[model samples]
Target chain A: MATVRIVITLKPGVLDAQGQAVHQGLRALGYETVSGVRVGKCIEITVPDQTARDDIDAMCERFLANPLIEEWRIERDQDRDGTGRSRVPVLPRSQGS
Target chain B: MMRFGIVIFPASNCDRDCVHVLRTVLGHDVEEVWHEAGSLDGVDAVVLPGGFAYGDYLRAGAVAARAPVMTAVRAFARAGGPVLGVCNGFQILLEAGLLPGAMLRNDVLRFRCTTVHVRVESTQTPFTRSLRDGQVLRMPIAHGEGNYFAPGAMLAAIEEAGQVVFRYCDAQGRVLPDANPNGSIRNVAGVCNPAGNVVGLMPHPERASEELLGSDDGRLLFESAVMWLETRKRSLVTPLRGSR
Candidate 1:
């Protein structure tokens, strides 16, 4: 099976009120170094290994995200072997770190 | 009397209010249509009322917009049937692509539930045909994500087409920054489709349609719609009779 991750974010000019509120909270917590913040969402779905890229793209365009105010990108991770060790970690650590 | 259909989603709270206003207050026939129903048969007009559908998961109106009944609603709208969506209903219309633009959280980051004045910018739509241009009406708006936003070119096109039906304004009908309650671009409180049959507004006109509820100014909108529908029916019949 292949896992598809879709990340959606508001367009550049659109206001991110929730993100701004979080930025303010970070500043209150002494994170003054933070310049700005923009919030977005990510959805992960598991589909059959034979699912075509075009089908996934269509799903994102039709229902996963709205094109008017938001933009979305898709990332696919295919599990080659029966073991899932090859799957990428949700949050991979920095290479140098 | 013209029959009105009010679509009731899983969490819709305003469907009954609309039915009461149309049936009891205005004395018109009303029907409550479930969201899953695929047919809007035998209704003169349709209304999508307000409330948190699908618990507003994913996004407000995002899930409900894909409900089964929307297909019928789209067909009805395409045929030039009148449709009015209020508050969350307005958000559904946007998400469903029945209307342009999307809503964002209020600039103040709070749910504003209060009364405000809006000026009728255009009287071409069925909902506002009886309202004079520039006439200010008092109504109550209750929502957190009522800020309207559209891309630059799309916004320009909407304005060029004169689709803006109502704009936030002060009591004297002056459009000013201070009068904008939700930070909507151009202070748009309500808008209609290019054909002027579908209208979506952030305000709760049903809540303000009675004097006991503080203002009866909203009643004019329903009255205007009835008058327009009646006139349209007459005109349709006149053409068939081969008379001017």
Candidate 2:
């Protein structure tokens, strides 16, 4: 099995009540048009190389993403060559590390 | 004047309580310093009281970190004044860069409150002078964000330097993981800056100062600061001109 790394994060510098905040002006205006406004989060994951993207998606929906509070995206990197042995994925597919 | 100032932002409900303990029990003159005002000119000590500052609107202390008063608080820390940030105040201190790392949500995802055990890990600073190394004290705590986290090396450095002032403990003061209230790393409940002049704790010591209210262990923290000040005051000032 091959190995890869996955990092899930709110979009860059997103207003993460957990990370950043809305520009003060955006909130004071009460743009009721804004409906519900909230920040997001960052989650990092590692997995086996051949693990289908669908399986990863399921993991996120079932556990990582709390539908009521957040939105997220995933990033990936392959263990290509050197030191790949040290970057094994806990998911069993990327076990070299 | 034996003046102490508390940094107050929008939702700091505990500022007055910290002051009450400071004024009534600790017997020191205290004031509520608004974060919008941003100055610690005459305060001998600075306290960051607990409560949901900025409604805990942004990551516990994140929003409050940018408040005007924090600027003064930061300067006060740089000048070596004794600073104590309790509960959310601790979170603010970290967010202001006076301390290290950030606080995260409870691992269990629930608001926790009640009496918890804490062990005095050090007595070197003004706050802990009343405590003995390894002594145990139970203090009441109420908060949603009490987990303390820091990088591995930073944690080790604080320990090696004797800056880790308080640790979560068992009833008898024995520190154990089971006593860890928020699933924090190493059961750490409090710590100080490298200079030892700044201390931050998650427990509400102010709540425990009166025997009628609960335990009296909280009084020591305030008393220790007074003792530290009395001893150091002579060194910092010369005899008054009229006294002679």
Candidate 3:
């Protein structure tokens, strides 16, 4: 089985109200280094065998994220060892990569 | 007679509200179209009602925008048919590319449900034909993601083209930051396509169409659409000069 990971974030110039609130909260808690913040979502899915990158891209475009305000990037977890090592992110679609 | 079609997607809680407004209050024929259906039948106007379509899962209106019924809705809009998208419907229209710009989370970061004052920015569109410029109306808005955003160039173009239909304003029709319920750029509450056939707004006009419910200003929008359709039909039947 292979694991698929997707990250979704709002496009630039779009307001991130929740992120701003979190940043304010962090600042209120005396985290002086917190300059700015933008909130995003990470989704993970498990699929059998090597799934086509185009299929995942279509899923993201059609259902996973809204292209008008949000953009999504997909990555596969190729190094899922028993030790729970860090997984490297790969670009499923070369969008300005 | 005007026939209105209210699209019903999974988890669309506001479909019946629109149906009631169109059928019971307005005395027009209304149809409840399922999201999976591919045809709109013979409805004169299509309305994308409010509520969390497809449970608003991945993104608000993202899943529902790709439903089979939307294809037909797009086709209808392309042919200059009138389409009104309210609240979640507006977000769906934005995602579907039928309208420009996108809706973002409210700057206050909360689900705001209250009666707001909006001024008629343009009176030429089918949705606002009955209204006059600067006319203040009380309408109800209920949504979490109602902040309208567009790129600078596109925003300027929309303003220049008179596509802005309604703008959040004070009771005296003054545009101010505090009057804006959401953080929409330029306080835009509703906008129409360049051709003025498709309109998308974050307010629940259907919910405000009756006097007993508080305000009936929303009825003017429906009346405007009906008037435009009737005028269009008349013009089609009798073309002015030379053509015949």
Candidate 4:
């Protein structure tokens, strides 16, 4: 099975209130070095290995993400070994970690 | 009496409130159209009431925008039928691409539930025909994602078309930052399509349809719709009279 991951984030210049709140919380916890934060969501779908990239792109454009205020990226995990190590982090890491 | 249809999605909670206002308060015929319905048969007007459809998954109104009924709703609007979307309904209209711009989380990062004054910006649409330009109406807004946003060029185009129907304003009818309940750009509270047939607004006019609800200003909108429809019917029947 091939797993396609769609990550959706607000477009630039759009405010991310939840991310701002998280950033404030981090600062309150003494992480003053955290300059910014933006929040987004990820959706993973399992399809046959022969699933075309266009189909996945259509899903993202039609329903998975809104193009007006958001941008999306897709990552494909074509093979899943028994070790289960193909998972990708949905959000980017902050400065320290 | 004109027939009004209120589309009810799975989580829609305000459908009955709209029914009450249209059927009971305004003495009009009302029908409840489920989201899955294939058509809007027999209804003269349409209303998309407020609620967290599909649990507001993905984003507010995202899932519901693709519902089957919207196809019919889109057709209805294209045919020049009046359609009003309130609160979450407004979000769905934006998602469905029937309206311009998108809704973002409130700038204050809070769900605001309060009465606000909105000045009528235009009476050219079916929804605001009974209201005079700059008339202020008190209505309650309850939502977290009511902030309206549009790209710079699109915002300018909307403004140039005079599509804005309502603007958050002070009691004295001044548009100011303090009057903006959700930080909607330009203090816009309601807007119509370019054709002025379909309208979407963040305020819950159904909840304030009577004086007992603290304001009957919302009733004017319903009255305006009815008046528009009546005039339209008369014009169709007497096109050569040239009396309109």
Candidate 4 C-alpha lDDT tens digits along B167-228? 99999999999999988999999988888888999999999899998998998999999988
Per-residue lDDT for B1-244 in model 1, tens only? Answer: 9999999999999888899999999999998999999999999999999999878777789999999999999999888788999999999998898888888999888789999999999888888988899999999999999999888999999998888889999999999999999899999998888888899999888998999999999889889889889988887422211111
Among these predictions, the greatest DockQ belongs to 4
lDDT of candidate 3 over A1-97, digit per residue (tens): 8878888998886889989989999999999898989999988888876789988888787777777678887767755446444455555676694
TM-score of each: 0.92, 0.70, 0.87, 0.92
Model 3 lDDT per residue over B72-105, tens place:
9999988778899999999889888888887888
- Per-residue accuracy of model 1 over A1-97 as CA lDDT, tens digit each: 8787778998887899989999999999999999999999999889998888889888877777878788887776644235634454567667884
DockQ of each: 0.72, 0.03, 0.52, 0.73
For model 2, the superposed segments whose C-alpha errors exceed 4 Å read A1-39, A42-97, B236-244
Question: What are the per-residue Cα lDDT tens digits for candidate 4 across A1-97?
Answer: 8777778999988988888888989999999999999999988899998998899889888888888789988777744345544554447667884
- lDDT of candidate 2 over A1-97, digit per residue (tens): 4444444443432223333135334657675455444445545565666778888778665445432223455555544336444344545566577
Question: Which order, best to worst by lDDT?
Answer: 4, 1, 3, 2
Where does candidate 3 stray beyond 4 Å? A24-35, A45-63, A79-85, A88-97, B236-244
What proportion of the true contacts does each candidate reproduce? Answer: 0.76, 0.00, 0.71, 0.71
Interface RMSD of 4: 0.8
Shift of residue B107 alpha carbon in model 2, Å: 1.7
Q: What is every candidate's alpha-carbon RMSD to the true fold?
A: 4.0, 14.5, 6.0, 3.7
How many clashes in each structure? 0, 10, 0, 0
Residue pairs with colliding backbones in model 3 are none
Stretches of candidate 4 above 4 Å error?
A78-97, B236-244
